[model samples]
Target: MVKYLVVFEKTETGYSAYVPDLPGCIATGKTKNMTEKHIIEAIQFHIEGLIEEKIKIPISKTEADTFVFALK
Candidate 1:
C-alpha cells in the first residue's frame, strides 16, 4: 500500500484535489469531505488504470509541511 500526497485547494464553486505523484489524477466536490471521498476514488481508479496499462506505479516522494507566522 503506497501513500501519495494529495493537495487540496479551495475554489469559488467547490474544493479541488489532486495527487502530486499521480499526474492528471484530480477530483472536485461541493465540500471538503465530499472532495476527499472523490479523491480517494480517483486515486484508486488511477492506480487500476495504470495496472491495466502495465505502467510503472510511481513511488510517493512528495512531502508537505506547514509553518505559522506572526505579524504585527
Candidate 2:
C-alpha cells in the first residue's frame, strides 16, 4: 500500500487535514481523531475514483519532519 503524508491543522472551530501527495483530497472534523478517520476514508475514496477514471495513481514522495530550535 502506498503511504501519503497527511498534514493536520487546527482551525478556530475544529481540525482539518489533507494529503500532500493527493491534491484535492481533504477532510475536516470536530476533533483530531475524527479528522484522522475522515482523511483516511477520503484517501481511499480518492484512490478508487482515480482508478475508475483510469488515471495514474500518484506515488507517495512527500515527507515531513519537525526541527526544534532553542533561543538563547
Candidate 3:
C-alpha cells in the first residue's frame, strides 16, 4: 500500500481531504469515515495516474503546505 499524506478538515457540511503529494487530489464527504473512503479511492487513482505517466510522486512536505490550510 502506498502511504500518502492526507490532510482532513471539518466543515459545516462535511470533511474535505487532500493529498499533499498529489496536486488536485482532493475529495470530500459527510464524515471522516466517508472522507477517508473517498480519499482511499482517490489515492489509488492518483497513484495509477502517476505510475502511468512515470511521474515521480514526492512524499516530502512541500513549502506550500505550511500556509495552504486554514481548514485543517
Error of 3 at 7 (Å): 0.7
Compare candidates 1 and 3 on TM-score and give the better one: 1
Better of 2 and 3 by lDDT: 2
Predicted candidate 3: what Cα RMSD to the true structure?
5.6
* TM-score, structure 1 vs. true: 0.96
What lDDT would candidate 1 get against the real structure? 0.98
Point out where model 1 deviates above 4 Å. none
Q: Pick the winner on TM-score between candidates 2 and 3.
A: 2
Number of clashes in model 2? 0
Reference-based lDDT, residue 34, model 3:
100
lDDT of 1 by residue, 1-72 (tens): 899999999999999999999999999999999999999999999999999999999999999999999998
If the candidates were sorted by their lDDT against the true structure, best first, what order would they fall in?
1, 2, 3
User: What's the lDDT for all of these models?
Assistant: 0.98, 0.97, 0.85
For model 3, state the Cα shift of residue 48 in Å. 0.2
Best by TM-score: 1
Which ranges in model 2 have alpha carbons more than 4 Å from their true place? none
TM-score for every candidate vs. truth?
Answer: 0.96, 0.95, 0.73
- Per-model clash counts, in order, read 0, 0, 0
Tens digits of per-residue lDDT, candidate 3, 1-72, equal 446778999999999999877888999999999999999999889888988999986675644446455775
